[model samples]
Target: MTPVTSRVEYSPIKRARVYMKHEMGIPERRIALEEGISPGSVSGIIRRYPIQKDATSCARSGRPPKLSDRDKRAILRLIKKDPYITTHNLIVAAGLDVSKRTLLRWLKHEGIVHKPAF
Candidate 1:
């Protein structure tokens, strides 16, 4: 069996703990040795996050999406319940606050083609 230490994804809580130890005046080298990580990693974590609040998550790039996965799933459920329903009704049934065009574009992106009523 592969060892549990083969791959390591450090959690934010652990990083916060390290920061707490650092704030207590523990040396980086000693902290690294005790935590089983490189001294450079310990130093990087200390420098990157100025405050404990920022230590929870790293900075991310790019604009955030308009709709969350839950919203998408909800819409998809509504669609699957009645696939031939028009976009306007779909928006109303889904209780989405977005415009018809925005919902249409998102549906297209998700590979759902709304069928037109005769």
Candidate 2:
């Protein structure tokens, strides 16, 4: 039979142990040894329990918006000027620098509806 290792899938149990161990001032190296993970992983688990933390224990800045507020305003102005404008024409009219699909997603997210071009 293959030998069983201390390694465990990351879950609530491991998170609890890492959090508790950290609260008790246990060193990262020792915690890693006990948890069968890298010291970095142990530290990450400890940080994940904080009130403001997300997965990686740091503020996650998602992808920066491709269009600035000015660009968005321009699109809205273009729409106000002609609500019937097709997505392709809107792109050419506004000189948008994104793909058609990306613009459609942005429009959808901003509550703008498009009549899918014929």
Candidate 3:
């Protein structure tokens, strides 16, 4: 009995063929038929070819920071001065424009986990 393998690896030749098809203005379906690969694979290969060739991947964009470095430093100093300060008190003391939820998120990101009293 022969063993079954689940992994499928495409060779450089297949990648080159996809690029060549795109260069020759061939449609994705036709390229898939000729290359014996799925149309989605052909489309993905063409789309990612430039990035792969340049060795540069796309950068991910997330929500911008509400507090700047200086503000964060001030908050840290405030926390250090009074270790038991509540989130609401910290926001008022630091004069931060952010909400208590935002402050808690920032504190959590800074590795300061606060558990509520039972």
Candidate 4:
């Protein structure tokens, strides 16, 4: 016996395509302007509709960092001088002992990759 197979679908993009091609009559800018979506999004739907097997997660967007240049510089200096420094050392130097995870997050936010000293 063979197992059943099913096709993946994305209703929203499909609807967007229909609106672009038929309901809106292939006017990408008009469709986007009237429907309040990006023109790029309209083009993407028309291009990727048939080839895409499933709905892919859109790339995330976000604001810039909260930390200042001074803060990042301080963190980088500390990491470079003693890459083996523990979270406790970081807390002691930076005056924030939130946790190892929080410390790591800040470090990553500053683009400081950890390299064990030992």
Candidate whose TM-score is highest: 1
lDDT of all predictions: 0.80, 0.77, 0.80, 0.62
Question: In candidate 4, how many Å is residue 1 off?
Answer: 51
The Cα error of candidate 4 at residue 90, in Å, is 1.0
Q: Write the per-residue lDDT of candidate 2 for residues 5-114, one digit (tens) a residue.
A: 67544766667778888889999899899878899888777766775333223344557768888888888999999998888998888888988898898899888985
The window of 10 residues in a row where model 1 has the poorest summed lDDT is 1-10
TM-score of decoy 1: 0.52
TM-score for each of the candidates: 0.52, 0.45, 0.46, 0.35
Q: For model 1, how does the per-residue alpha-carbon lDDT over 40-84 read when each residue is reduced to its tens digit? A: 889888886676464665454566766778879989998889878
How would you encode candidate 4's per-residue C-alpha lDDT over 3-117 as one tens digit per residue?
2556233476554554446444657787667656677766666676555445443443565545556755766787789888877787678655356776678777557776667
* Candidates in descending lDDT order: 3, 1, 2, 4
Backbone clashes under 3 angstroms, per model: 0, 0, 0, 0
Consecutive 10-residue window with the lowest summed lDDT within model 3: 53-62
Misplaced by over 4 Å in model 4 are 1-66, 108-118
lDDT of 2: 0.77
Q: Rank candidates by TM-score, best first.
A: 1, 3, 2, 4
**Candidate 4 minimal-lDDT segment of 10 residues:** 1-10
Q: Please give the distance, in angstroms, between residue 96's alpha carbon in candidate 1 and its true position after superposition.
A: 8.1
What are the per-residue Cα lDDT tens digits for candidate 3 across 1-118?
1226673446667787788888999999999998898888888878887777542334446667799898899999998999899888888888999988888887887898767799
